[model samples]
Target: MASINVDFSVGQGAISSRLYGAGLEHVGASVYGGFWTGPARPGDESRSAPPVHIGWREDVLTLARALRPGILRWPGGPFSQSYRWRDGVGPRGDRPLRFDHYWAKPEPNHVGTDEFLDLCRWIDAEPAITVNTRSARPEEAAAWVEYCNGSMLTSAGALRLANGQPNPWNARLWSVGSNNWDMGAPEAARRHNLFARAMRGVDPGIELTAIGGNPSNQSEWDKVVIGQTAEQFRHLGVWAFDGVASVEGDNPEDLFHAHVASAERILWTISNAAYRLDEMMLNGGAYVGVDGWGIWKQSRQGLQHDYDMSDALIAATVLHGLHRLAPRVGYAAWGNLVNALGLIQATERACWATPVYHIMKMFRDLHGTEATRCTVAGPAVAAPGGNSPVRSSRPPYKGMALIDASASRDVARGRYTLSVVNRSFSDRHDVEIDVKGLPTGIGATSHLLRAESPFAANSAKEPRAIEPFVFPIGQIPREYPFPAHSVTVLIWEETPGLT
Candidate 1:
């Protein structure tokens, strides 16, 4: 019998502000065809009609609000550096036509700055714009910020007014580039650096994020870029940092593990430089390969490969990493909101939330206001490469029990929630939580999400593949079999006298 003990007395710290927000870049149909089609005409109900009203989708807005996302990235990943603000502004008819370097599609400029701002308003999310840095100039970057955030009295402000948005937008969160290091082309870093300098001159208060290298060379890039850029902005007295991480994988399990390891590596790199983790975005969660255009596919084969039984476990791993390293990590965002690795998938006719979405919602709803310290003491599960210890260890946890736990306390409510993910595929582990020293009592409500098959998913036709169940904790007794491939959220409330 494999058993584990958890002590909730040792508290970690407060939850990170970054945990509150997510990102939606201009990739796939995420922005254009995905979320931003205008509302249908008075009588037309066609699926092709714009799914989002005023270039925003209601389903996407609803999901974003549920997460209480603090900030949303806009306009581009690689596309941002090549994007021209003028093309995305002004009347849609008059807006210039351009090519989206990333998705290989004609840039319609339909969801311009004003429209994005409107979408943000609808969802109640803060707008974080990424300016064109590769081929753009400092003056261009500064002027764009002025156009959006500056007062109406300025020239750029006048241009914004002429474009039908009377007042300056007052956008605060901004970035210089996206993966400027990976294009492997000439003048990439130089263009990004120039944009950074000019953006500071526009509005000193705006938060600026500089692009770092790829995940493979993250540490090396951090050492070089942060070392140099820190000096450039030292005189201007602005906040400067790097943007790292990308979304690509087959299933939630593998993707989740990669995200956990990547985050740790990036955090370590940024910490060594004493630089702030300003705008670190996680990999894509919604994208599936369609005609080999994106990393994942839309077929069941692709879905099973990328998002099956591993998704819930992966999500647990991510939450645990963020909670444990709350002090260093800030501003973590998922790839998109609607389609292409998003939480919600919407067609003009209908909408549905993914299993990952439910997991995220559960985390948002139950995880308390602050992180608490908790550790697992149980039989060691062997690593895949055998129990023999070797130099340069990479695996964070050893063994097969696959136990991950996060504890949080709500000071005002006098409640604590423990979220645990058991990764064992065949055997069930018996968990014993030692709550003797906890300030609160032991009664708890447990919510479990599990499936018989690892490759299960919720489709438009069949929408109930994955769901949660709630039951009294004590009813199950000491030997609770946490079914194979499952996520469990245990809510413990205090008994008035026991405390």
Candidate 2:
């Protein structure tokens, strides 16, 4: 049995709702079959006439809308470094299908800048465009900003007007370049500064995010980039997709324990990096933006993996950790929104939300903006050695709690929400919670995400196999049973009067 104390009077920080954002890359079906699957070309007269061409499938769009994605990054993930924006815009018949050197596939360029923006508009999502700096010059990247956001007086803007878009896309978020360690040139930092200046010159209102450093080691790279581009960028970009897998004849629970601890360590590193920024004395308060996240499973052609319930639980833990980190983490986008390690799997005819999708939706729809401080006193579990999910210089910390939790209070709705993840493999712990500075008699609603087994998953055939089950409690209980390897969210209306 575990007794947890949650103090609503103590506020950790404000949770950034955009932290739950997801990304879309131009690789694999993520674009073609995933987003742009119209019967006719985008600019064709048939697209506007009867039997109009819907670029994105209706069912898929409807499911995505439910997730309420705050921001969507476009046409990237190593593809953007070499991508030529000019090739994707204009009449579909005139646009060229170019060979993608990175993915070694033919890119039809049918869903170009205009198409991407149109999709964003349809979904009501903020556009986070990554500019090509590895293969394109600063002026080329600057032209992209102008085309999307500049007035018709500008050259690229004039082209946009000629192409039929009367108004600017007015995109605010931009990533300077791809990962500098892999594809970036030695002078890429300087080039990023040049790109930032040129793009911002076109529209100073836009927010620029530059590569801070490799996620593995960010100190040196952070210092280098901050020295070069002091105040040009608003956020320093970082990527994380840590996952656990069972080895030969090993227990699966071992992997889940290791994965949760590994995820926490990575978050701590991000927080440390933000603290170090104070010593660098940068101009604006720049936060870490984990724009690329999700397991990078080894594959031949595409990055798609059948995410199990354990994977979904790990993702829930990650989301909880991000929300707990609060104002330090400005935004986080799950890798590939549609097919490449996507939350929702989509075929031409149908789309199915994965277990991870349900978890994300639950957190996004339920969690509030203000993070509250919480404490847990329970029998702690230790992650076994040599079972570390990722290579780390240090071992897992001693006395890591078996139960991980985060809480928030929504002021406008007069509600409070608590997200808790039980990391135990086989042991079901009794959880007793006390909310300081609060009265009783509050009605509570609980949403539980669990399955018969951690390895359980949902496929296209069984989309709701591991969905959430909601129950209403007459009052907030003094104690509850938290099952092993599960994610639970408790929400209640905020009591106005004091006890």
Candidate 3:
């Protein structure tokens, strides 16, 4: 057992709202059945019974709102290149039907561009549209942006107005490619440049995210995309870099650890640059229906790996890396939001948030945009060194702690929140905090998200497995027992008078 001390103070710098740019993609029922299917829609009468009213959409919106998400990436991963905005926009009867490549299902195009924009509006989230970089031309990409953000005078803008949305949909975020590797390198590079140039040419006001390679190949892809785009699109207000998720290994834990390590590497590379790049979109976690590799796995158990505790821990660790390096890593979008490989699973009858969802929600709810310094003098958790049941093949960090902790101070509210997670399987240790440096006269509250049963989880049937509980801390305690396998968030508020 060891003790940790954290010092926090009000600062003038504000945490980037982009830290909250967590997004999801719809491949399976994630969009249509999960978020858009109406009660009146022809389907299983039981599942479709609830009309597709604002209420149903509001449920997912509520979740996104609670997370204070800054942006919602839509429509595709690999599927984006084939997605046509026109097909998904107007009335359902007029929309053309298409086959979904990723999910091998029929895409009715019911949840089109308009619906997605409307969804973003309802949740007050910025829409991050993924254009067809692999298959569509630069003009096509430009048209999508023009339809969304251009004034009603232009051709695409006029089409948008004719579709019933009179006002131009001023969405600021756009992704040039989804999974560029699906296409070869030469073609991918050409497509990436084309979309980048087109997007900039169409709407100089929009922030563009040009696709790089998988995180593993970031150095190579960054050299190409960033280097090439820097010359032409840099002046067009295009900003941000995008990477796909690729963790090498079959074991779930190993895959998780690999992704974490890769995420750390992405942060390091992007942060060390002298000139500030707009943002780096680090895509991590299991892709829907995919196994350890980015391709779909057949085993049902393999498909549900994201629901496991080991995956949850890995997700948390990935988030830890993101939060720890927030200065450099500007944006993070979970590969897919609703279907196939997603945080939320939707059946015709119901939908439930998975373990990854809970973990991300926890991070979103408790952690702030800015990273604070935390020092711990405690026993280190032995790195299983890729042997742990979770199969993380990445080399271990030296002297990693059984207790992982990070802190942030919110200057506006004059408050500090410290998040601590004990990853130990057996050791239950008492913890202490030294917040003497924070501005004084502040009240404090602590919230713990833990379960009496280490294996307890939130399921579709029982969704309350690991929820949050708050405790008041009038005085800083010298010690508090931290149960193994738990995450604790301690909040300190500035009270205004006493030191």
Once fitted onto the true fold, the runs of candidate 2 whose alpha carbons sit more than 4 angstroms away are 40-53, 183-186, 282-284, 298-302, 385-399, 437-441, 494-499
lDDT of 2 at 209: 86
Candidate 1 lDDT, 47-125, residue by residue in tens: 3453455546666667666765555667746667788887778888888878875667787787788888877776677
Model 1 poorest ten-residue lDDT run: 286-295
The global Cα lDDT (0 to 1) of model 3 is 0.58
Q: All predictions: root-mean-square deviation over Cα?
A: 7.9, 4.2, 6.4
lDDT of each: 0.59, 0.76, 0.58
- Model 2, 1-499: lDDT tens digits are 7777877667888887677778888787887776667655556444442222356666677778788777888877688888999998898889898888888889888888998888787766778999988888989999999999988888999999999997999998999997656643337678888999999888899888878665565777778777777678888787765554433347566655655565565566567667666677545477777778766533526475567777776777788778776767788888877877888887655578888888888888888788888777777767643232343333545666888788887767777888888878777878998877443567778899988887788877887888899888757668888888788998887653211
lDDT of 3 by residue, 1-499 (tens): 5777766643323345554454455555567666666435556455554444642454554555565555677775667778877787766788888887666779887777887787777666677778877667788788888998888899988988988898988888677676666455556667667777778888787666655554355455555555555543321111122111333355433343333333333334344331224432222210011001111222242233224443454456555655665544445665455545566655555556656567666666555556777677787633423332222234554545566677777666565777777665555779876665676566667776666544455666765555666778776668877876666777776753212
Error of 1 at 233 (Å): 7.4
Candidate 2, RMSD to the unseen true structure: 4.2
The candidate scoring highest on lDDT is 2
The C-alpha stretches of model 1 lying farther than 4 A from their native spots are: 1-10, 46-52, 164-168, 182-193, 231-306, 379-401, 413-415, 436-438, 471-481, 493-499
Question: For residue 464, what is the lDDT in candidate 3?
Answer: 55
Models ranked on lDDT: 2, 1, 3
**1 against 2, candidate with superior TM-score:** 2
